[model samples]
Target: MNTAPRRPVQLYRALLAAYPREFRGEYGAAMQQLFVDQYRRARTPGERTALWLRTLADTAMAAISEWLKAWRTAPPAARLVRAAGILFIIGGIFVPLAWWLGTLRPSFDYPYRYQPFVQDVLAPALFMAALTAFTGGAICLLLGMWPAANGHQRLALLSSALGSTASIVGWGALGLQLGDSWWSFAMGGLTLFFLGVLWAGLAADARNPLPHAPGAWVLAGLWIPVSALAGAVYEMVTGRWLDGPDWVFGLALMLTSLGMLWVGRGLAQMPVQAARAQDGGDA
Candidate 1:
C-alpha cells in the first residue's frame, strides 16, 4: 500500500482552512482525505504540482465568489448605504465637469464669461443634478447611521447636508446674477468647510481604501485650504478677485471632484461588518 506524501497532504489540508468556518467544519476532513487519495494516485511529481496549483487557484476563486454572495445578501440597510456612496461619487464627478465646461468660453473673465450654452443650459442642469444628488446622498447616509453613529459617519452626514444646501443656494444666486456677491462667498466657504470635515473623517477611518488609491484624498483635502488662502491673498494684493489664471481654479475643482470620488468609492467598497463597526457594532 503506497502512502500519500505527508508534507504535501498537510499543505493541502492547511489550504482548505481558508474556506468559511461552517464549510470547513462540515466537509474539511472528507475533502482532505479525497486530496490525499488523489495525491497517492498521482503518477509523477509534475502531476502532483499541477494538482496543487489548480487547487490553489480554485480556492482563491471560491473565496471571492463567497464574498460576493455575502455582499449581495447583506441587509437592506447595508445595501442602501452602499448605494448612497455611489450617488456621492456620481455627484462629485459632475462638479468638475460643470466647472470645466463653464470655463471653455472665449474669454477667461471673472464670473459671466461663460458661453451662452454653458450658462443657459449646462450650468443650471448640472447644479440641479448636484442638489438632487447631494440631498439624496445625505438622507441615505443619515438613515444608514441607525443604531450607533461614529464620529466619521456623523461628519459625513453633516458634510453631505451642507453640500446639498450650498448647491441649492448657489443655483439661486447664479440665476439672480449674484455670482460674485456675498452669497457666492458664503457658498464657497461652506463647500471648503464641508470638504475639510469629510476628508478628516475619511482619513481617521483606517478601514477606508482611499489612502491606497492614486491622488489620495489627503492631498485633495490639503489642496482646498491652500488654494483658498492663495486666492484670498491674491485678491487682497491685486485688488481683484479673478486675478488668478483660469486653470488654477479648474485644477482646484478637479482635485475636489477626484477626492470626493475616491472617498465615495472607499465607502461603497467597505464591508458590511466594518460599516456596522462605524456605528459601534461588532466588526
Candidate 2:
C-alpha cells in the first residue's frame, strides 16, 4: 500500500497545533502516526475527506474539554472571586430594575407621589431585592479580594474593604427605609468612590491581568465617577434629587454589572492560565 499523502499529514499536524504546546509535544507524534495510518487505509476521496472532518471535530472538542478541566482546577480564591463578580453583575441588574418598577414608575407623574399598592407591596419587595443584591455583592467582593490581599495587594485590599463596607451599609439603610435620606447618599457615594478605587487598583495590578475583555474593568471603574458627575449636574440644574429617567442609570448599572461578571470570570480562570504558562515555560 502507498504511504499517506505528505500534504494531508502536514495539514493534520498543523490542526493539532491548536492544542497547548505541552499537549502537542507529548502526544503529537503518536497522533500524527495514527492519522497517517488511517489515511493510508482509506481508498476513496470521500472516505478520506470524511476521516479528516471527523478528526478535526474530535480535536476541537477535546481541546475545549481539556481547557475547561484546567479552568475548573483553578485555586479556590479565584473561584470565590468569580462568584463575587457574578453577584456584582446580578445586583447591578436587579437593583436598577427594582428602583424603576417600584419607585420611579409610580412617582413619574407626580414626584414622590405615594401609591398605596406600590408603597405597601411592590416597593417592599423591590427593597428586599435590593437588599439581597447589596448583601450578596458585598460578600462576593470581600471574598474575591481576600486572595489579592494575601498576595500583598494593598490597593485591592483597601478598595475591597471599603466597597464591601459600603455595600453592607447600603443594605442596612435600605432595611431601615432610609432610602432618600442623607445616609443613603453618603453610603452610595462612598460605594461609588471605592468601586473606582478597586478598578483602578485592578488595572494597575500587573500580577493579575483581569480575565475579562480589555477596557471592561476600566469602563466599569469609570462609570462610578461619570455617573456621579452626571447625577451631580442633574441635581444642580434641577435643584432636586436625582430621580427618574431610569433608563439611563439602569443601562449604566447593567453594563457595570456585566463588566464585574466578566472580571470575575477572568479571575477564576487566571490560576489555570498561569499554571499552563508556567508548565509551557518549564517544558
Candidate 3:
C-alpha cells in the first residue's frame, strides 16, 4: 500500500498568516511539526479534515488576539487618554452652540430687525456648526484606539459613522448660509466637498482595513489642526475669531499633534512585527 504525505503543508503555512506575530515567531515551527505529526497519525480522511479545521480556527483566534493588542504599538494608556481628550473637545464645541442657540435665537429668526444674514444669523450658525463638526470629527478620530485595544471594529465603525455624519450635516448647514460672495461661496463649497470626501473614503469603507485609511485617529489628527489653522487665518484676515477664544486654536494644534504621535507610534509597530513574522517563518 502506498503511504505518502496526504496533507499539503502549504495550506498550513497559508493559515499561519492569521496568527499573531510573536506567537507565530516563537511557536510556528513547533506547531507545524505537531500538525504534521498528527496528520501522519490520522487513520481516516475525516480526521485529517478535522485537524485542518482546528488549525485554521486556532490561527484565526491568534489573529484576533494580535489585533486586540495592536494599540500597544501606540502610546501608554493611549486609548483612555485620547477618548477623554476627544470628549473635552466635543464639550468645547457644545459650549458655543449652546450660547448662540440661546443668546442669538431671536436675531436669527427675525433678521430684518438686525444685521440680518451676516452678523445676526448665518455667521454665528456657521461658526457654531464648524466647531461642532470639529468636535464630532475629533471623537470619531479617537475611535481607532478603541478598536485596536478591544477588537471592537463594529463600535469603531459606528463611532466613525456618527462623526462623519455630524461633520457633513454641520458643514451643509453652514454652507447654506453663505451668500453670493465668491470667496464665501468658495469656502463653503470647499468645506462641503471635504466633508463629502471624508464621508466617502472613511465612513463608507469603515469595514475594510484600507491601508490608506490610517483609521480615524490619524485622520482626526490631521484634520483638526488644518481646520483650526484655517479658521485662525480666516479670523485674522477678517478681524473675527470663533467664540472669542483665540487660545483654542493653539489648543487644537497641541491636541492634534498628540493624536499624530499616537498614530505614528502605531505605524512604527508594523515594521517590527513584519520583521519578526518574517524571521519566525524562516525559522
Candidate 4:
C-alpha cells in the first residue's frame, strides 16, 4: 500500500454534509477551511476531537437556522401538504378520541341525562375536532421541515389556525355540558395547549421574534394550578366543584388558560430564535 496519509481537510469536508443544503451552500467551504486550520494547530487526537465537536455544534446550529429560514421562505408542493394534513388528523383524533373512550367506559354515569350530548354527539365531535387540528398542525410542522415544503408549511399554518379555532369552539361546547357556561378546567387546559400548537405552527412561517413577553412566564406558571384552584372556588361558592350544575366558574378559570397558552407561545419561541441566531453566527 502507498504510504500516503488521509487529509484532515478531506475528513472535515465529508462531515459538512451533515448540514442543510442551503447552509452548506453558504458556508461549507469556509467551515472546512476552519476545521483544517484548527486540525493543523492541534497536536493530539483529543484536541482534534474537541475541535471537531465544537465545529459540529456550530454546524448543527447553522443547519437548524437554515431549516427555519427555509420553512418560512420556501413554497412546498401539494403532495407534501397533503401528507402533513394526514398526520395532523391522526394526532388530533388521538387526543379527543382517547378522552371520549375514557368517558364512555363504565366508571361513571356518562352524563346521559344531564348532558345528553356528551353521551351522544359531543364525544364524537371532539374526537373529530382533535383529528382536524392535528392534521393541520402536522402539515404545518412537516412543511417547515424541508425547503421544498415551504408552501405546504403555509397551508399547514392555515389549517392549524382553523384547527385551533375549532378546538376553542369544541372546548366551549364541552363546557356547556358541565354548565350552560363555556368554562372548565379541562377546557381551559385544552384551549391553552391548542393555542400553543397554533402559535408554534404560525411562528414557524411568520419569522416572528421568539415571544419574550412577560405574559408567557405568567401563563406558564399559572395555567395548571389556577385551573385546579378554580375547582376550589367553585366549591366555596356552591356546594361541590367536581360534578356541579353551575359550571360558569369553571369556564372562567378555563378561559384564563387561554392567556397561559398565549404566553407559552412566546416563551417557546425564544429558545428557537436564540438557537437560530447562534447558528447563523457560526455559519
Worst 10 residues of 2 by lDDT: 274-283
Per-residue error for 262 in candidate 3, Å, reads 19
Error of 2 at 185 (Å): 4.7
Question: What is the C-alpha local distance difference test score of candidate 1?
Answer: 0.64
Measured over all alpha carbons after superposition, the RMSD of each candidate to the real structure, in angstroms, is 10.0, 9.2, 16.9, 17.5
Flag clash pairs in model 2. 211-266
**Global lDDT of each model?**
0.64, 0.59, 0.48, 0.49
Candidate 1 regions exceeding 4 Å error are: 1-72, 105-115, 145-149, 152-156, 178-182, 189-193, 196-215, 236-238, 276-282
lDDT of each residue in 223-278, candidate 4, tens digit only: 43455567657888988865534345334334443443444333223233233432
Model 1, 1-283: lDDT tens digits are 3458788877887897566443566678888887888887778989988888888998899867764675576565566666666776887878777776666655664345546768668866785675566567666766664434556656655665666566567666767787556455545744554464355455444543222453455544556567766767787898886456878877877876677677666656655665555455566
Residue-level error in angstroms, candidate 1, position 154? 2.5
Q: Which of candidates 1 and 4 is the stronger one according to lDDT? A: 1
lDDT of 4 at 74: 34
Looking at candidate 3, what is the lDDT of residue 223?
54
Check candidate 1 and list the clashing pairs.
none
TM-score per model over all chains: 0.58, 0.53, 0.31, 0.28
Q: Please rank every candidate by TM-score, starting with the best.
A: 1, 2, 3, 4
Candidate 3: clashing residue pairs, number: 0
- Name the candidate that leads on TM-score: 1
